[model samples]
Target: MEQTLQTSKMVTEKASPLSRRVTWYIFGVMFSINLLNYLDRYIFSSIANTVAKELHFGLDGIGFIASAFLIVYTVFTLPLGFLADNLSKKRMIAFCTILWSISTVFSALANNFLSLFCTRMLLGIGEAGYYPAGTALLSQHFPSSQWGKVLSWWNVGTTVGLMTGFILGGMIVSTFPHGWRLAFLFSSIPGLLLGFLVWKFPTKDTETQKVSLNRQLLKQASIETIKRIHQLLHIRSFVMLTAMQVFAFFFLGVTVTFMPTYLQQKDAFHLDAGTAGLYAGLMVVVAGVAGTVLGGILADSWQKRFAGAHILICGAGFLLGALFFAIAMLSSSFLLFSIFLFLTLFCVNLYNGPAAAATQQIVSPAMRSSALALSLVLAHFFGDAFAPSIIGIVTKYIDPTHGQHFILNSAGQDLRLSLLAFCPIALFIAGSLGIWGTRFAAVDQENVALPAN
Candidate 1:
């Protein structure tokens, strides 16, 4: 039976073609799953203040909880990445979705910080396998000719899920008396349901040959995995890009984490916890959608003419996003701030699709999951995971007089302003990395075309 399943996946991989409609369907389904994954994470951000207050968590404590998710995410990512290389991508994804959903549902039942932290950590473990497996599945399902475009659209799910989570989670929490717990519960349902769909979905032909799961991963990860990651790390361009991305994401995490509180404190926008969450969620949705669509289109067009076009475009987008955000911070008008926020999100998202495609093209198929996993490992550990928590601590420093008193109101702006410094620096570094990627584009092309393990 296992051998038959393996044979089925190989046939699917070889037969995957560049059909337009099928490509779109693949994008839609994958995007939906991606969205759900993020929605699960963002629920906490939308209610950071409420949770912190209720749990009596200080800045450091809150940061630790946020980072706890990543600690587990990082731990599981590489193992799962290797698993994707050896196992059925479809089954792996289905299992992961269910695991995470169960964990998320339990989040609402936690009574203390430790329990909540452990639940989130478990949630991270389930989520860890998602990206590498998802990416490998997409690559196998689509022809190489269409990878750039399909991956971009697939990447769009991140924005969509985040936006939905923010908007839905925020509104629910705001409107209902017990909205916070409800928010976590509501998000879990869709994910749990999606696991069934994922199972039903056809497996890629290349994925038919499932490897023995009993095989230990750390020992099995190829020399190529080590060499490729080493090469990626050593590349001056990638290093700069990673550094920039870390900072950019750090700023994003901090902002989103405290956005509701920022508005309440800075703009005097009095909202129920849910309303504030909805507003912040909307910000991510609008910005994420616009940025992804436009960025994907631009990256696809540029890739045809220039080897490093995607990276260049990514750099430019980040720079534009940073400028808009910086300008928005300077202005006090709510209307102006909204426009800038939208613009900033748009620019920031431009990198998502292109980065994923580029990463795939740069590494070997056998090593693809690990390469991507390593990236996520680095990004989560260094970027989004601790960003919100860091900003929370920073806010405390900015107004030590208030200590924890100002966490809910009037003090978040100081943190926002201080965080402004992170964006431009990140953009500059990302742009420099794009330039570096151009030099090795040919080398990557040579390595990527090698046959799968």
Candidate 2:
């Protein structure tokens, strides 16, 4: 009987998707995966200064190293995204989780910039594989009416992961010698364990052999994919949303990558690394969590009355976020900076739920994963992928500043100038695009409900 059950569970069936109990279970697994995904990816931010010191990398090298992961991440998103719609999402997520976890282990062993950069690239592959698949799976499980709330919960996982990554990275680094490496090793364990759980999750009877699933993919998948891509692009709302993601991620990359170090600047907060990490983590996570959850609830409520509520909320959030972020940047008072920083984080995070839900809603159920994957490919590539490096280059050219410990010419000035020049303007663009997206949302989403040709 045990053998029979094991064999039965390994086959895919075209029945009701899942029971309520199993649905929640799968949600738990995907949520956990999303959380760990961000944590592992951004822990590097917390330890970047320390690693740069040892590796003799300046701001440019630091930014370049950060971009390495994004480049590979961008490269892999579409292929895995294509597979997610055709293959077993659970298994693919499992494979990605395990692969990235092992890669992170190797990151601990890296002794040079090149070795570490290579490991980060591997990490990117895992993360890129998980996101679209996870989002697609959840989309199928929930009603469109509930998509905002559901994805908001998913976004919470991402926020928490980022928080844990920074806080843990700081605490561990402060507590132990070579703590940065240990942080990598420690974080990898949870992902390794979670990967196995996702692989075996929900039921034994619904699993499909990867090889068999491959045979079921579109016959002329390349041509089919292109057609689908073109179809999605024809939707004016999708185009506007994609444009929003580009600017949003770019400025987000600049701030997330450099803010911790910014806290350590002599002319700024002058906090130690551990303190800096804690403050950054707490501020971002708390505000991010509140914004994501509230934004979803509010958007969903507003959507009933307005066709473009998602984009409307996102536009408002970005505008408010820009204001607070700008205040944080220009203020000399630590108190005012901290307060505005919190507001900035909250406002910016408001986009998470509405934006994610919008993508899922405006496309056919069949194209959910592919649409998101393609969007991410473009978003990260043009946005965060090069943001760090570009900002680093800008910072590198600035004149030096004298400081006590860990001073590197004018590195602080470089980071400050780079952030100020780009962040507000980027948010302004994203906000404008999002607001314009509202005009087309009702029409585009209506098309998704039409009968298939």
Candidate 3:
């Protein structure tokens, strides 16, 4: 009976396009939710000045508040990722939505840094399960032929979410005298509503081998799960891919965390938080979306000719992203700076779709969730977990005499310079890792057994 169930699952995975479309629809809905995830996380930085003033916190305190979420997000992602493999993806997303949504609203109500930190941590617990579950659900639902395109569409949510949060938050703060809190509060509504939409949608069962309902199924062992994760890690491709993820995320974390402040300080822009967010969001929408779609299309097409095409593309993107970011940071003209930032975002997203698809392709269907989770763990651990805090520390050390006015416009110049150097360094490492990843794709493919469907 157990063997029959496993075979049935395999057949279903192979033969069902009709059912797969339903998964895509859900992917679209969930993708929108993902956008909100980032919006809530990112808008804080855009309005850092106002938040710090209102809360009476220094740069270190602000960094701690921001880092709190990433720390929780990083710590919980591994366990939640494991749960995603074993549990219902739909339920996981729904419950997490509620958790983060509530925390987001509570963030608006916080009286002190500690209160805000606690709320962010709770939000992290909710968000922690999202990526692994979302990735696994999409992979299971989509066919191999369409995985790159489908994942690319899903990836659009990140840009959209960041843009929406920035623009919307910025608008609210500028229009209203005391609007930053309202902006955070407003961002939570869409997610809470989306949670309802997800619950109403029919959920597909996880494509796992069947276990005896009459026996202790919950306690059953999963040799395949352990073996697959072990094999994926040992694969040189996976290792290098993970290194690439780490580098990409590190750059992403630092840039996102600091960009708004840099703009205000370096450009001498006096725009309210919402206006700054609007500009940044527009850049992401224009550049980030284009890069993601193009990358997916290129990877899908290029892979037919070159076995390591995806990694090579990623390598090129990272190198370009690094170069563009350095130009953006150093440019004296703000318009030219914006152009560079736009190009940098474009370059970064160019590699995202291909990298994700390549990672899954090199793992078996049954183990793809765990494999991706492991990749995420390594990425977040070495990348974002310490990023915001590190930037804050760097700022303090670079210009310690800036004193309590760390939130002032002048202090950000040194911060931007430090980040300019650090971000490029991380991107360069990621670019090199991408090249290293390409070399081992053939060997990795041998162990994971690509999908026949």
Candidate 1 per-residue C-alpha lDDT over 303-380 given as tens digits, one digit per residue, 9 for 90 to 100: 665656666667777778778888877667778878887888888788887777767666656666766787777877
Model 3 agreement with the true structure over 290-398: per-residue lDDT tens digits: 9999999998787665667678888889999999999987887778888898899998988877888888767776666677777887788888878888887777777
TM-scores of the models, in the order given: 0.88, 0.92, 0.90
Ten-residue stretch with the least lDDT total in model 2? 4-13
lDDT of each: 0.71, 0.82, 0.77
Per-residue lDDT of model 2, residues 1-453, tens digit only: 343233222321233367888878888888888888889988988888787887777667778878999889999998888778767887888999999999999999999999999999999988888888888777766666788898999999999999888898888887888899999998899988899998887643222224453433556567767987898889898889988989999988888888887787776677777998899999888999999999999988887767688888898898888888888888888899899989998999999989988887688777888889988988899889999999877776663432212344325655677788899888988889999899988777667665678
lDDT of 1 at 1: 35
For candidate 1, what is the total of clashing residue pairs?
Answer: 12
Better of 2 and 3 by lDDT: 2
Off by over 4 Å in 3: 1-24, 209-229, 266-268, 450-453
Model 3 pairs in collision: 170-274
